[model samples]
Target: MKKTAYFIIGLSLLFSLLHAQDFTYFEKEKNIWLQVYSNQLKAQALDSDIKALERSIKEAGTKKKIELNQLLQLQTSKKKILDELPQSFDTMLEKITVESVKDINLIEYLFTSQKGKFNIQTQRLKILKQEFDDAVAFLTKELATTESQENRDFFKEYQLKKALDFFENASGLLENKEEVLKRTKQSYMSELEAYKQTQLPIHIIKIAILFLIFLLFNLLKYFITKKIDNEDRLFRIKRVLNITFFLLILLMLIIFNISNIVYAATLIGVIAAAITISMKEYLQSMATWFHLSFGNSLKVGDRILIQTNNNQIIGEVINISLFQVTLYESINNTTALDLKRSGRTVFIPNNFFVTNYVYNYTHDRMKTIYDLLEFKIPFTCDTKRVEDLVTEVTLEATEKYMEIALKQFSSLRKRYDMRSREFRPRIHFIPDTKSSCFILYIWYAAPYHQIMELKSQLSQKIVKKLQENEIEFCSN
Candidate 1:
């Protein structure tokens, strides 16, 4: 009995050693995960601090410009560290995916204990991207607003340069992001396909039945719509249902987790944001177009004058678009008396609404303007006769046109929300210091297109009348 007991004890000891040897490899893997867990905890703490710093940077006022470089350096370092940590986790995950986990509990460990590590790292990266963008934008604004030359150079060198470089480096990850995502999706898809294999035949049969039913239903709907006269509406419905089917397929991919949907969506969003930032001028112009369109602000055929480059660009607004406004050139940099068209069309950006002041002459009706024109006469001549001659010649020239303007304005008031401003031909003889003559201020109101011609005619007629009346005029 003693010999039998020794033999049994020896056998039990041998079995224990062998069992330990079998699990020894997995035990080391678990230990490695433990070390990763510790690193993850430290990373999480660092991420929290980084977030705090980002908040402070955002809230920092203009006075904090000097400290921006230091803050950026620290932030960049933390982000770099955080960026480095993911490689370790990703390496482990790659092993997990590639290697067969013989022990079922190891898979559970990854889901439970290591899940936070994965999720937190992803969040850290996402937050870092947003923080970096915010910092860059903030520093740019600060640079523009800061009066200090020192601060401007500091921002350009340290803040903007570093931030842009970091962002560019981070985006480089996207170069292989597609490949990584493809592998991940394939790994998940392979698992899903294996799972589906068990009941694939049955599922296929069910799917075929449903597909036939859907096809039949669509055919019925098509026939019904075919009888209706609204072919366009029916065609649109068909397109919508087809798109729905496509979305349903994508939804199934997501449901199976074979799509790498999150990574793909995030990547596309980042790329899209980059594209949008690059094309901000176009987008802003489009937004401005929407604002103008909705506000019913400006329209074609409305005469407009915009002040630009210390010159008033007077033209008839020929065409209005999101990108540009086409203007038929009427009067240019010369004199207002230069009413002849230069035959040059002006293409003005829609963004002109902000920096340049737009003078829309014709809002809801035809363009009519009152030109304040001044002419000098000798102070020795009778002021009363000059005023009467001026008034009479102006009246003779514009009487019929003014009558028409009154009627047109009355009709325009009915059509649009406007009050009429009138200008009857009047000559005011004001005292002049430079010339020994009274200034004949002619307040002429007429159609915009005809104002130049009418003014010329009025001037000639008044001079002829003055010459007949023997009135002396002064020259500048």
Candidate 2:
């Protein structure tokens, strides 16, 4: 209660003091203080103006120096006049002893001034801020110019360099006025930092978007080409897509403003060229794959004969890959009969296509192939009769195969310039005196894949027929 009474007493005193003042006396004092504040600012401006005159005089000819010094002296007089104006305000302030509205106004004036002068050096600060704003404008113009240039990468570097130069220049200008320019410095640095912050995310987004586009383009190209059965065509299209992706990246790297585009591109090119030169066989295989994929000569699932190291690798193509052709190997004995699968998978590099001849049975629509089986018969049998019987029986046995083969290889006949072909056994009489025997060649045609089954059946039938006829066969 005592503390409350004291506060009330203090409030009453303050109100009584305010009421005692004349009408608008505090407002009058405040206006007077405002004038004093304006005069103090003028004083500082006069000082700076005089200093500027001095600097101008220092750089002038003798005649011009005299002229500038006279102007500097005139400004010094004006500063002296302003200097006296603050003292009058101080004297007036001392006469107001009561803690009234005028006193509050005086306190406000004191807070805004020090040593009877304006403490705020807004003129110099405004000039410096204008300089910073001008520099920012110039920087913006530089960015616009950089954006207009054809060499975006180089010009963006130039833009950043010029921006840094402006920042350093502004920093140096502000360094001497650290106390006064603190806020301006913060504003300048924050602006630059903001630009960098925005640029970083944009750069990251550019790279990510470019990568996604590259991946998507490749996936789309792959899916579109995936259904194609032609290996060489697919390989060619993929090659073009890959090269396009790389070039697009090179082009967009400039737009992304990545600093290392030239260096990165050069590095990639050097590494790729080195790898290409080092892996000649791999490169050759890729080229060979391209050729075979479009050459219509060899494809996956086609039966082929790849002769290597003085031996023949007869196989059905299982896969056609970038570097190699995979095969499911098969074999036929030297007699061209008893064809059987060896069950060995073979990988033949496409490079070997350049160095060796490849035979593809499925090319030219010649899916059916002919093989001959020769049997040595004793000279005791009538050779003419045996040949006729063997030919007739073999023709009957291969009748179905011939019907299908002739229909399929109509293309082959046109390709090979052949008039007509008959599916029948051709017997030649070869006298082997050492065994006193003659050989009969039983020729027949069958699909390459069904050759083994057809040969086995024909061999069994021929043996059974000979046995039934009581024909004696010579074995060497």
Candidate 3:
């Protein structure tokens, strides 16, 4: 009860102090403050702002409930003006003069609390506010009527949205429109961004379609080429296509008529020359192929000896080409006996013909012979009989091999148009130690294989023939 009495005493003192200020100035200030604060509430989003405004009125203990309800309605009329608040702090403050206007009545009431002066200022502010409200209401009505007529005439949803955007933007300039203005501005930016994003897919689709056309053209060209067997016809077709495509590319590169065609053609010519020079070695190889084709140089089957790195390769000609030649080594063979000793082939450059000698055995002469002699007569034997026997055997062997060689030569001569009949096999006496007499020899058509056999056979026959002739031979 004592606390309640003290509160009542303080309230009475506050009321008396407010009354002593002439009440009129306080009344006008109270009305303007209430009007501006309530206008801020209405311009905000509907639900939160309404609840906030109710809470604010309840918290203002100086005002009665009935009086606050009336102020709320009066302030709603000023909501449009309050909603014109600028986004920028400076611009909004300048436009609304919120602080200045709030302090004006307070300062006037503090200086001279007069009922007449307070009423005049209050009436002026009310008139100004009413004019603004009336203009807003009239304009809104006119716009609504225009929209209704346009709806009757038929309006696109897109056009309506555009109009909504314009009106929302204009309404954002009001004194207390921050919340709604910010939301609407975000929506506008999002819509514009969506429109820009949609155009990107349009460009992507155009690129994809162009790529598809290019792939289709390449596939068509591949299939068409596969169907043709004649290389020349295909090459001609390719050349024409290449020329057409070249011109098309040129046209694309130089879209304007003022571009220099001659300069571009010159650049192309330079590139072609550089390519040709780069492939000069290949061209030289092609020339070698031409030489082989024209029957000027040795072909695949010609024998040759290539001196390389201080070593000699005597081999049969196996395979030949513009760039390389292959050989079957013939060094270890008498009658192609060691032909298999070396691997299948050894490749030699055709350009080797320019600096190396080629030897073709089959092409040169067929009656070639290599002869060797081995004597086994004893030291104690009659030297004369041995000499005669050796002579006779060697002569007989020579004659036998010569006969076979001449026959083979005649056959080859006829077929190859080669005069190999002049080749003859011969034998000569050679120096030997006292224990043996050697038969030096030249032979036709006999290889190292048959040389041993022929010597053995002749030795046996000479012994038999000399024995029948009573030839004395010494025993070893």
Candidate that scores best on lDDT: 2
Candidate 3 wrong stretches, greater than 4 Å: 1-284, 331-341, 364-421, 429-439, 447-476
lDDT score, candidate 1, position 38: 38
> Residue 473, candidate 1: how far off, in angstroms?
0.8
TM-score of 2: 0.43
lDDT of 3: 0.50
lDDT of 3 by residue, 403-447 (tens): 756666676667666654543434444555554534334343454
Candidate with the greatest TM-score versus the true structure: 1
**Per-model lDDT:** 0.61, 0.65, 0.50
On a 0 to 1 TM-score scale, where does candidate 3 land against the true structure?
0.31
Q: Tens digits of per-residue lDDT for model 2 on 136-230?
A: 55455655666788877563455346544645564544444544344543444464456456654665687689979888997879696868778
Could you tell me the lDDT of residue 469 within candidate 2? 74
Query: For each candidate, what TM-score against the reference?
Result: 0.44, 0.43, 0.31
Candidate 1 ranges with C-alpha deviation above 4 Å: 1-272, 291-295, 331-341, 411-420
lDDT: worst 10-residue window of model 1: 97-106
Candidate 1: C-alpha RMSD after superposition = 25.4
RMSD from true fold, candidate 2 = 29.6
The best-first sequence of candidates by TM-score reads 1, 2, 3
